[model samples]
Target: MTSAPPLAPSFDAARALRQARETFDIEAAAVAGLKNRLTDAFSRSVQLMLEVRGRVVVMGMGKSGHIGRKIAATLASTGTPAMFVHPGEASHGDLGMIQVNDVVVAISNSGESGEITVLLPVLKRQGVPLIAITGGLQSTLARHATEVLDGGVDKEACPLNLAPTASTTAQLALGDALAVALLDARGFKAEDFARSHPGGALGRKLLTHVSDVMRSGEDVPRVAPDTAFGDMMREMSAKGGITAVVDAHQQVLGVFTDGDLRRLIENGIDLRTKCAKDVMHLRPRSIRPDALAVDAAELMEEHRITCVLVVESDGSLVGMVHIGDLMRAKVI
Candidate 1:
């Protein structure tokens, strides 16, 4: 008989799952440890970011460097001006980019990397303030920095305990925590973000207003309540808008638009039986004259129509603004 096939090696899936849970717990502990440790150093970092007259330069090496870049970007977007600098690049003459007025955030787990350590003497000589994020409080980097943020973890999540995975994740979380703390301390608002990001959608959403972008005065298509359907049709045509505002005593009575006309015709209703009160949409959705134009645009979109009523403090029809008006002015 042929020799039996060799049996496969025994593997327990439950054991593998237990190992994964152990690694997860290690990382969780690393993060949970941070909540109780925030002290004066955190406050000082916030104060430094607030008082910084120039950009914050973030420096780190290898994996820490990657985390540094993300931290810098988060800081910049949240009100603090910041940028990333590689430790290796700084050693090769990029150190000149730092100024005495600027703050330097140097990250290192060992706190003894040659590339980062080499810049210390020069930074000290130039009077640049240094902040360190490190695992070991007694490491050279911590000793040299004006502020030391503890990024310590009990152990790594790697199976062999040799990789930087869990340590780097912890450090990244700590950096983000610092940035968000600074952001709140500065009372940074959406308006401030809009100023920094004029091209971004958030800026557009928060900043663009109707008054700044709406068409006004005689250009608005309008007619008296008693005006004939023929005259209202002419007004709509002349204004090239979907609707015309009807007024009496300078107060808006109703709105006449193409949709209204279609509904009347489709039902075979008496065209003459319908006057402004009978044919026009009564008490149509209206917007404050002083409200943001974007609000008006939103109203139009919400109703799946292209027209809006612009009302005054006394509910009078001061004018009418259309989607075209808002779009042409780029308010929409």
Candidate 2:
């Protein structure tokens, strides 16, 4: 018989919980320490980035490289033009991606990654400003950088204290601080952020105006208030489920929906001769054409209605937006 496989270690729930809590406490303390360390150098780094004619080129090695990628993405999304460049890749041929007008943010806990140190001279030669984020004040990266933002941690959360834990946490927090500071300095607005993030729900809420999604012109089922109930039913059928009861000037007097028809039929009203004004819902909910699609959704949900009239400033009906349209536009 083959030798039996070694037994796995027994599970220890208490030990696992203790270890997780210890890790969280250590990382939290590391991030908290950064508050006292924000110095004039941090401000200068933000100014340097603001003045950069080109992108912020972030570089690091190993774990720092991973954190650097996230920092670059945060910077880019928050109005700063930033990209991550692996130091090893820089030596191979990617250094060409960096330009003299760009600001380079070099991250290294020890500040002695050979891959990054090796490219320092090249960056210097190109006149690129270097901002260093490192755990050591006297590290090689700190010495060569134009500005230094200390990302030091008291100790690692790792049991062996060898794996990067608290140090990376501090670095990531510092990177976020930098991105937010730059965003504020640039006066970046919510609409600007929405423009960059147009694929998500938040973007739709901010960027989609009512006119863009509302059914307008002839597609809007509009009937005069004096219209006979038979003609009103035809208008509702042709327009889907509802019709705008308006005057000759296209000013919405009221709205007639399928629900209203059901109530009328239940009240034993004769559909053949009665007029739309006799059974229309007066003071129906209306939204301006310039309002956000999200606003329309809110109104529909609040009133428990399926559609709302889009009107101009003068109370004239301009369009109609249905719940189905909002759903198709992913605004609901």
Candidate 3:
């Protein structure tokens, strides 16, 4: 018969909480310690990466490898071209990915990872610069490195003093510092980062133009200035909740919305005899089709209105954007 599963040990919430606090203290100190250790080598490393013609190839083993992957992604998204290659795979044939123009960032807490050490001579032969993130300054990886970054920590947060908790934190923090320095050196901006992250929220805000999300053609609700109030209300209800008042050349005269209708009724104005021009708000806020979708959202928010007209330079109405449209596009 199959044996039953073993029961879990008794819980210790207080001890668990104490251990967690100690872990935070140890890791925070590990990262903070790096600030004191920063020397000219750190700036040189950034300069080397900034001048690289090709990508930054990050390599590490196990946990360091995980941190290396994140570093590569951060660097790539921040304007530096980078990629992660597994060290073990490099031993076989993936080393071919490293070109002379590429800069290799190798992470090893002990600075003597056998897999990485074995590739040092080959990297040197290929003339690829090696930046080592290691706790071992006198170790083999550092000896072959073009630049040495101190990633040492006094101890691990692990109770046994064996796990890589503090060391990995230091490595990650150092990697982030390098990326930030290179980003500034390269003059990378938010818009440039957004181009690399087109599907993200910031990308949508910066890259999405007014023409992309506005309702155009028949979807836009528009009526001549002399249109009957009842007819304008029909157009508004059929479209969204707003109608644009336009002239013979389709230039925007004004706009009327559900908000205006309520205010007119509150003032006891008889709408049955009025036309679109009589009730429309003059000089309604408008945006151009070339502006960012986020700008449209900001316009609606600033005026406390639900919609705005997309117009040409000459004030001709082209499209309409509603708050709901911006919401659906997630520009806000």
Candidate 4:
């Protein structure tokens, strides 16, 4: 058999990177263009959302549906109650999700998506306000909307100029802008965001209290200020690292950590005769039980300590938290 010629490399890494950059540049420009187009329509959408007694129901088809779902999540997380419904599914009974008090945000690049346009009359008859995000202001979707926000793009990022690229980017940016406006108007704070996302790391950092992760009750290593150093060592070892040295009233006087023990040993102090009060570090770093876990972590990091005592406002030790506890809680 005759030998076949070696095939040339089919992949061009440089060209691929150049094409990706081009796509990003096009979309960036599209989003940037939306800044100058911000008008009364944008304000009207925000006002409608702010006044909504019901959820913001977002509807779109194809790629717009994907973007709409993200927009809905952003709105819901940022303090606005919102949800996305596929327009095709809405016609098949999902329309029931829309209530008269809800504001409908219908997205269609051409404003002529059959799946979305067909529901316009039903939505209007139900007395629901419709906000259209479309490239063509004169499109059918825009004509039916109570308010219209132009999401027009000069061109698609696709070389063929057919794919929903730049237009979707504009829609996503506009949706984010609306969500932020609503968030500011509502005075939504980080605590509110943490409440909405209690399962995420940010929630843990912002919402997890010192009491939630502190070692409490008998698990908290503690000793009286006059306790023998040997006895304090036993308590610290039993509890695995540090012990709070408290007074007669169970008020924390100081903390004796493993580092303190090492320092005492280096100084050749008699461990059996020395008292905890003689070797403990006074006014040790501490946090309140109600403080955020992240705050505890920050205190520990700032002092280069491994553990902190959780105390009451009156300096009574209630619990103890270690760096490991914060790490395990994902608050670090």
* lDDT tens digits by residue: candidate 1, 253-326: 77888877788789888776444555676777778767877788889999887777777778776566678877
> Model 2, which residues run further than 4 Å from truth?
1-7, 266-268
Clashes of each: 1, 0, 0, 0
Q: Once superposed on the true structure, which residue ranges of model 3 sit more than 4 Å away at CA?
A: 1-9
**Highest TM-score among the candidates is held by which one?**
3
Arrange candidates by TM-score, descending.
3, 4, 2, 1
lDDT, model 2: 0.94
Whole-model lDDT, candidate 3? 0.95
Flag the better candidate by lDDT, 2 or 3. 3
Choose the strongest candidate by lDDT: 3
Q: What's the residue-level lDDT of 327 in candidate 2?
A: 93
Q: Candidate 1 has which clashing residue pairs, if any?
A: 210-293
Q: What is the C-alpha RMSD of each candidate to the true structure, in Å?
A: 6.3, 2.5, 1.6, 3.6
